[model samples]
Target: MSGQAAIVAHAQHWSGTPYHHRASLRGAGADCLGLIRGIWRAQCGAEPEPLPDYSPSWAEAGRDEALWQALMRHMTPAFVPADGQVLLFRLQSRALAKHLGIQCASGAQFIHACPRAGVVQAPLSAPWARRIVARFTFPAVFDRME
Candidate 1:
C-alpha cells in the first residue's frame, strides 16, 4: 500500500488505545501527539527529531508556540483541511495551540486520543471546528490520494 494509505490504516488500527501522556504504543497508550508520532513511524520510518518530555499543561505555562514550530519544521501548511491533514487546536483563548488530531477520510470526522475517551473518531462539530488554529499535511507520499 502507499504511504498515505498506510498512515490512514495505521491510525485506524490505533483505535481504542488508552490515552497516556507522552506514550505512543498503539493499543496500549497514546496521547494526542503520541497518536501522530505513531502514525508517522508507521508510514515514514523514524521521526526527524526526538520529542522531549512535556507536561499536559506545557503550552499554557509558556509563551512560545512550541508545538506549532515543531510541526512547521516537518509538515506543510494547508490552506484547507482534508483527509489525513493534521489539525492543530488552540483549546483556550489567548493560549498557545497544542491539541492535535488527524482528519478522517470522511472529513466530517477526526480521530484523536482524547483524555477521557482514549483514541476514537469524533464528529468535527462546530465547537471543535472553531478551535482549530491550523491544518497541515504530512510530507511527500502522505499528501497524495493514491
Candidate 2:
C-alpha cells in the first residue's frame, strides 16, 4: 500500500471510536488530535515528541497558533491539498485553529472525530472550506511505505 493508502486505512479503522478529551486509544476513546496521533504511531513509528496536556479552552485562552506551529514542525506544508493530507480548521475566523481531520478521496471528503458523532467521513462542504487554515502532509519518510 502507498503511504496515502495506509493513512486512509488507518483512519478508517478508528471510525467508531467514541470522543474523549485527550484520549488516543482506538475504539476505547479519542479526540481529534488523538486520532491523528494514533495514525502517526501506526504509520511513522514513534511520535517525534511528547504532547502537553491541553484543555478545551487552551486555544481560546492562549490566542496563539500553537497547534499549527506544532504541525508545521512535523509535517510538510501542502499548497494543494491531496488525499491523506492533514487539515487544520479554525472554528471561527478569530479563533485559533483547534480542529483537525484527514483528507480523503482526493480532497472531496475528510474524516474527523466529531464530538457526539465519533469519527466520521464527511464531505468537504463550503462551510468547512471557509474554516480551513492550513493543509499538510506527513513527512516524506512515510510516503515511501508499502
Candidate 3:
C-alpha cells in the first residue's frame, strides 16, 4: 500500500484505543505521540530512533520546539497539507507545538489521539486549523513501502 493508504489504514486499526500517557500499544493505550509512533512503525518498518521520556508539561517547561525539532529530523517539510501528512499543533497562541495528528480526507479531517476520546477522526475545523504550526510528510522511503 502507498504511504497515505498505509497511514490511514494503520490509524483506523488504532481507533478506539484508550488514552495512556507515553503508551503506544494498539487496542490498549496510546497518546498523541504514541499514535504517530505507531503509524511510523506500521508504515515504515521500524522507528528511526528511540524516544526519550517526557512529562505532560515538558513542552511548556522546556520553552523549545522539541517536538517540532524531532519531526524535522525524520520527516520532510510539507508546504501543502495532504492525505497522510503529519500536523503539529500549538494549543495556545504562545505555546510550543506539541500535539500531533495525521491529515486525512485530503486534509478536510484528521485522526488524532484525544486525552479522553482516544483515537478519533474529526473534521479539520477552523479551531484546529488555527492551531497548526507545521505540516510534514514522511520520507520518500515510507511512500515506497509495500
Candidate 4:
C-alpha cells in the first residue's frame, strides 16, 4: 500500500476513539501518543519500541524533547507535506509540542486524537498548519503493497 492508503485507513480507524491518556485502542480511548500507537499497530503489526511513562509535563523536568526523540528513533521523518504523514504540533509556540495527528485527503486535512474531540478529521487551517513542528511517515517496508 502507498503512504496515502495506510494513512487514510489509520485515520479512519481512529475516528470515535474517546480521548484517554496513554490509551490506544480504536473507538475506545487514547491520547495523541496512544492514537499513533494504534495507527502503527494497524499498519505495521506492533510498536517499534516501548513507550515511556510521561507526566503531563513530560520532559519539563529535564528540558528534553523525549517525544520528539522517540519519534525520530522509531519512525520515518517527513519534512514536507505528504498524504498519510504523521504530524506533531505544539498548541502554542512557547509550549511543549505534544500533539500528534495524521495527514489525510490530499494533505489539506488531518485526523487526530484530541482531548476535546477524541479522534476526528479536521481541516489543516492556517493556524493549525503553522503549529506543526514535525512530520513522519510509515516506513516503506511496513506497507505490504509498497
A best-first ranking of the candidates according to their lDDT comes to: 2, 3, 1, 4
**1 or 3, greater by TM-score:** 3
- What local lDDT does model 2 show for residue 100? 93
TM-score of candidate 3 on Cα atoms, chains taken together: 0.90
lDDT for predicted candidate 1 compared with the true structure:
0.83
Residue 56: error of model 3 in Å?
A: 2.4
**Candidate 3, residue 32: how far the Cα is off, in Å:** 0.6
Residue lDDT tens for model 3, 74-144: 99999977788889998877667889999898778999988879988899999999999899887763642
Model 4 RMSD in Å is 2.8
Which 10-residue span in candidate 1 carries the lowest summed lDDT?
Answer: 137-146
- Model 3 C-alpha RMSD vs. true structure (Å) is 2.3
* Alpha-carbon lDDT, every model: 0.83, 0.84, 0.83, 0.78
What are the models' TM-scores? 0.89, 0.91, 0.90, 0.87
C-alpha displacement of 115 in model 3, angstroms?
0.8
- Model 4, residue 71: C-alpha shift (Å): 0.7
For candidate 3, which ten residues in a row score worst on lDDT? 55-64
Segments of candidate 1 deviating more than 4 angstroms: 1-5, 58-61, 142-146
Task: Give per-residue CA lDDT, model 4, range 77-128, as digits (tens).
Answer: 8877888888988775566778888888888998887778888899999998
Candidate 1 residues 1-146, lDDT tens each? 75555666777888999999999999899999999998887666678898976678624856888899999999999887678888999988877888999887667888898888999989989999999999987887543221
* Prediction 4 global C-alpha lDDT: 0.78
lDDT of 2 by residue, 1-146 (tens): 78877898788888999988888899999889999998888888788889986766424745667789899999999988788889999986666788999999788899888788888889999899788889988875363222
Error of 1 at 100 (Å): 0.5
